[model samples]
Target: MAPPRNSAVKSARPVLAPLSIGNATPSNGGTPFRKPILTKAQRKAAPASGGIRRYQKSTELLIPKESFKRVVTSTVSDASKAHPMRIGKEALESLQEAAENRLVKTFEAAQLLAIHAKRQEIQQEDMKMIRRYQKSTELLIPAAPFERVVRELAQDLMSDILFTKDALKAIHVEAEDVLVKIFEKAQAFAIHAKRVTITDKDIQLAVKEILQ
Candidate 1:
């Protein structure tokens, strides 16, 4: 005699085995995973995977060579002469490099001053104070004579632009102030390097330290 339909249907259903927790394998494969550990040196050398990265110094030149050369030519050129003074390629490069170094050093000193004051940004006051400090310690040059020279340099550099007496006077003051700051930084660089004389190389090194 045939079984009842309900009984047959119940019998046709397959039974599932109970899962073994201890011997269970991952769906990906039977292989167990382990993280690779790094050594102290390796860990130290590795870059951070997350969060803000530290600032890195750049090796590239900041100033444009053509513009620097134009300014240099204007400063050194004789107005009485018909033709402008010629600069050798090597001489131009050296001048540009030196100028860049001095500028970099000045910025570094200003930045340090800002940092010391718990400030994130450098201010004009910081620069002015630096100049004031330098001026206090150094022997004073006659302001009238120096300002006259500065006025001539400014006129030569920008012959097309007409400057008022007040503008020229401001320019003279600014130029003198900046030069004082730059000299202070250069002297600090020399002293830090344990040398009595401030060399072009010291200024170059100072720039490298800031931007390398």
Candidate 2:
């Protein structure tokens, strides 16, 4: 006798192994994002509701078995190789000896020392600039004169102190002075266009105009 086939009785679908995209390093909270592909069988056996059941289980570590190991190894090896170059014991000792013996600086040594010295000088100049502006503000004068003096001093100090690019500092000071003067007279500021670039001659003219 032949067995009766029923509409309700269905054969179990074959589960296919998953595939991985690319290998990447692991982190404290792994946030690997990938676009997954449905197996041929999985596509055909679509859920009645059509929602992906696999995604509901976990959002992390979804790579294929083979690439998972490779990713871990690659991350570790890369980190070790890229670690900072250490001055080894012998090299450190030699450098110390050279420093003690040589009165003249080598090119590399001179460059390093010069940069460090410049940074220190720049810091000191900034402090002095602040004090100079304080003095200008404290001087007994009308608000207009006080502001003009402060602006000029600040611009000159920015150049000497290296707080800003030297060329722009003068322009900044001059713009500030113009704005302050206009506000004092008109009770409102002129709509500022881009700053008019003052040259050495312009700076000389401004000082002569204000001081005289």
Q: lDDT for each of the candidates?
A: 0.69, 0.46
Tens digits of lDDT, candidate 2, 1-212 = 98787654544546553443344324333445567899997876564443434543554333453454455456656777867344445654555445433422232234333444553223544545445654573423344564565567877868554333444545556666775454322311111222223345444544555556
What local lDDT does model 2 show for residue 208? 53
Q: Write down the TM-score of every candidate.
A: 0.36, 0.15
Candidate 2 lDDT for residue 120 = 21
Cα misplacement distance, residue 138 of candidate 1 (Å)? 3.3
Q: Give the candidate number with the greatest lDDT.
A: 1
* Candidate 1 wrong stretches, greater than 4 Å: 1-60, 78-84, 133-212
Runs in model 2 lying further than 4 Å from the true structure: 1-51, 57-60, 82-212
Estimate, for each residue in 43-151, the C-alpha lDDT of model 1 and write its tens digit. Answer: 8657563521232245555677888878888777856366656889899898887888877767767877876788767999889977786567443566578767766
Quote the RMSD, in angstroms, for model 2: 25.5
For every model in order, what is the number of clashing pairs? 0, 0
